[model samples]
Target: MTRVDFMQGNIASAEGALAAGCRFFAGYPITPSSEVAEHMARRLPKVGGRFIQMEDEIASMAAVIGGAWTGVRSMTATSGPGFSLMMENIGYAAFTETPCVVVNIQRGGPSTGQPTLAAQGDMLQCRFGSHGDYSTIALAPSSVQEMFDLTVKSFNLADRFRAPAFLMADEIIGHLRERVEFPDTVECTPPRPIREGMLPFEPEEDLVPGFTPFGHGHRVHVTGLTHNEKGYPASTDPDLHERLVMRLIEKVERARHEIADYDIENPDAEVVFISYGVPTRSVRQALLDAPEGLYGHLNLRIVWPFPENLLKKFPNARVFLVPELNMGQMAREIVRHCDQPVISLPRLGGELHTPQYLLDRAEEYR
Candidate 1:
């Protein structure tokens, strides 16, 4: 029989990691996200997995990448400042096509603004946080249960695509406690397979070929440079580089349908509520309070590799309102893809959006 327990969102995330076959964890403890690390520290050992507290976030990220290369599913948890420190390694994971989960329980800041406060300010950073043209996969969970479910999905998607998957959360959700039920046996998908004795840079359809671990009898050369089939650094030929980059981009872009998650409520409603992370809870409440056929919503669980199809659903919505704990970052994306009037309801670190606030906005827009 399955059991249900009340747990903080961070703990739920860690439980999800364990369920997803994550056997290795490396991260420094930070506010809100520290509990995730703590849970892993205790739980992983019992499961015969490994857990290590690195000196900093950079090393933590590096260790997880190494663990992934060794054929172990791995993850790390950190907040905003630590996320900044892990940016370079995150890019490294991207270029190497290493599969790992990064849980960012977002706190305020450009640089440690509010360690205990919540913010969705890292939305843009998750997409452009690292310095590169590579594609990123990120998921935002609005509730504690989602924190659990999405963490497992993050690992599955990361292993499936051989890319880093992010669980973008905030302090409120990370620290909040809620009752969650678990299945009898957790199911985790197997990693994608690279061609036999495959060359690292060998291009295949959908842009991504299968993968082989280092020292696995494959002539695999991993680097952050533009390369060809042999994986050797090759940048002089413009055509070769263009083809290489496009393949990487297209792999995610082409698979956008398989990668995005958008829940629509009352498709014919005049007003649409757009939000992610913890702010989405408010949007849900607003939906509950709204009259039938009055309001619609798009709750984006997967932020990166943006759901182009979902946006097309309400391209000309009468009014689209995005509320985030930041200065209109995601709202800009909605505006960019949407051919409609997008309204901004920005908040900074400390304050969180409430159902009442959204109700007021719905009335104002109506």
Candidate 2:
């Protein structure tokens, strides 16, 4: 039977990780996200799993990578500052194709801007912060229940792509309390092991190499430097490096359509609201107050890779209005894909746009 409870989002996310077979957690406490680590510390031991609170975010990220290579599903949670500290190692994880999950319950920041407040400021950073040309999977959860659902989905995507996956949430949803339904069992996709004769970094048809866990007698070599199929450093060779990097990108990019998760409402309307995360709630409210067929909504659950094809679903769209906690981060991406006029309704300093605010914005375009 499914279990239901009134839970906070961060706790639900931790429970989701546990259900998805996360046996290892290494994290440092940070505001609005600490509850995740707190829950993991309490719950992991009961399940015979391990939890470690590292000295810093850098150490936390490294520990998760080590745990992943040991054949255990690993995860970590943080907010803006900690997420920044993890960038270098995050790049290393991407280059080495380590499978792990990182949850960032975003708070406002250029540098510690608002620790206890809600903000979606990390949306672009999670995609490009690592300083490399590698692709990754990121999920955005709008509600407490989605916090559970998407965190489980993050683990599955991490294992499937052999790349770092992220849960990019915000303080609003992370701290909100709501009833969540827990599944009897969460589905997971175990990493494919390398065949005996195959090289460690060898790509299959999908461009993702089979995982060779440590202590498995596979004699696999892993490194952050550009490597060949045998996993030896080949950084000096131009073509080999290009091939390696391109495969890392294509593995996720080519699969965007298959990975995309979104909802389209009133597709034929001329005025559209493109949104994700907490702002999506405002969009929902606006739709309720508007005429039945007056506005279209594209609520994206998976934000990275941008799901550009979804734009075609609204052929009659004359204007696309995007309201987010950050100042025009995703709006720029939307502008690139559609010729329709894109208006950015940016909010910062930890406040969500009111439903009336969105409706007023849409009214102008109408």
Candidate 3:
């Protein structure tokens, strides 16, 4: 097989999922993200994998979780409105500790605001859109290569951590065509199997429980309610509820450092730019034009658990400038973590900030 090819980001993502040993795909076809599903439909069967077009995103998410319990790596792709629909079941996946990947090719939306245009409006949604207090693992890809690399990484993280993982790409990355160099073999980590005698949801030291594949004599009860280690509903017990909720959040948060993927440059510079996903493209261009040691940069690959510790790497930074596609969804997270003044450069519509646009804004403080 050719290891390098020019392909769209969505197709690269599907190839990544296939490369990661994802044998089952279930999703509703939505704009900007539909190509991922389309590609999977054609590719999965050739790989002896299965693909299903569900009634909607909710069912798509449910089917993914169900397929995962059968010991197969499962995934789904959707855009903003569809992403919103999946929130409920996504919570169920989190509460149940199901290892699966969700690709959200973000489009502008409060309610279908922009179907084809790109936006990072759903960054906060992926982290907190689902009902309540569970932490999530989300990866954002800036290029076609990363769309593949991060999709594979997302699956590894999901299996290693035993939680729902997200490939948080936007429409810009999804539809863009670029050269992607595939690895001869990508690293893989299957979900840790259940021990001889352990409850379904009982966690190990890492706060992640081993997975029990459904079928053949091993049976595990799975429920969305606050459950004990046995996977039975225990919503009535406040103590059990607290313990369960805390563990769900803590498993990812506790592993934040281990889960964090980012890049830092010119750590001693006075003016800094922190961004993830597509916005980082602009940051890179801005950096190239600036003088040596003129600006610091922090680009995140794994965003959720947010990686606030990366901020402290730039000690001399007087202002942390953030340019995002939405109205500063992540800027809010930055504000709480850093003492430095954070300037939120939010582009409300689908427009991306240009390199010149960012550099000009920095002149005041730079």
Candidate 4:
């Protein structure tokens, strides 16, 4: 039977991870995200899973990557400061092609700005925080229910691409309480197993190699340094290094359209509001109260690789209005992909844009 209950967003995310077969969790307690670790501690052991509270975010990230190589689905959760501490390991996970999920329940800050407040300031950080060039998938949820749905999707994406996936949530969604339906079962796509006689890092047509877990007798060597198809470090070979890095990026970039996920309403409207995360709440309300044909909304669930093609969906669009908690991080991407006038509505200090505020902005373009 399906179970329905009123739950907080962080709790729902934990439940979703459990449903998605996450057997290992290594996290450091951080505000707006500690509940995720707390829930996992209480629930993982009951299901015969492992949950460890690491000394800090950096150690937590390393533990999760180690857990993934052991053939278990692993994850970690954090807020802004913790997220920052994990950047080095995040890059390591990307270079090694380790499949894991990192959930960032965003809070205000450059340095511990507001622990108990909501902010979407980390939108860009998740995409480029780690040094070097690589591509990873990121999903943003706007509600308590999506906090569950998207967390499951993050695991699926991680395993599918053999790369780290991020759940970029904010404090508002992390703490929000709402009704969520727990399905009896969730379908999971496990990693493709390495076949005999195949090179460890050799990729198939999709550019994603089959996974060879540790102790699998596959003779695999995992390293963050540039490597050859046989998984041996080849950093000295310039051409080979280029090929390795390019493949890592193209595996996700070429599939951008396939991984793209969003919601489009009033596709023919001249004025449009593009948003994600908590700001999406205000956009929904503005649409509901606007006059017929007044404006449209493009709500994004997946934000990385910036599905540039989605801009064409609004053929009649004269202007695109973007509202975010950051200082126009994603709005700048919109401007790059579109010829239409792009306006950014930025809100900071841990507050959400009111419905009236969005509607007022829409009127300017209309």
lDDT of each: 0.86, 0.94, 0.92, 0.93
Ranking by lDDT: 2, 4, 3, 1
Error of 4 at 226 (Å): 1.0
Please list the residue runs of candidate 4 whose C-alpha ends up more than 4 Å from where it truly belongs after superposition.
none
lDDT of 3 at 166: 95
lDDT tens digits, residue span 217-258, model 2 = 987889999999999998899999899989999998898888
lDDT of 3: 0.92
Question: Where is the poorest 10-residue window by lDDT in model 2?
Answer: 189-198
Error of 1 at 293 (Å): 2.8
Q: Where in model 2 is the C-alpha error above 4 Å?
A: none
After superposing candidate 1, which stretches have Cα over 4 Å from the reference?
Answer: none
| TM-score, every prediction | 0.95, 0.99, 0.98, 0.99
Model 4, span 126-155: residue lDDT tens: 888999988989999999999999999999
lDDT of 2: 0.94
Q: What does the lDDT read for residue 14 in candidate 4?
A: 96
> Lowest-lDDT window of 10 residues in candidate 4?
191-200
- How many pairs in model 3 have backbone atoms within 3 A of each other, for residues 3 or more apart or on separate chains, i.e. clashes? 0
lDDT of 3 at 200: 84
User: What is the per-residue lDDT of model 3 for residues 72-184, given as tens digits with 9 covering 90 to 100?
Assistant: 99999999999999999999889889999999999988898999999999999999998889999999999999999999999999998888999999999999999999988
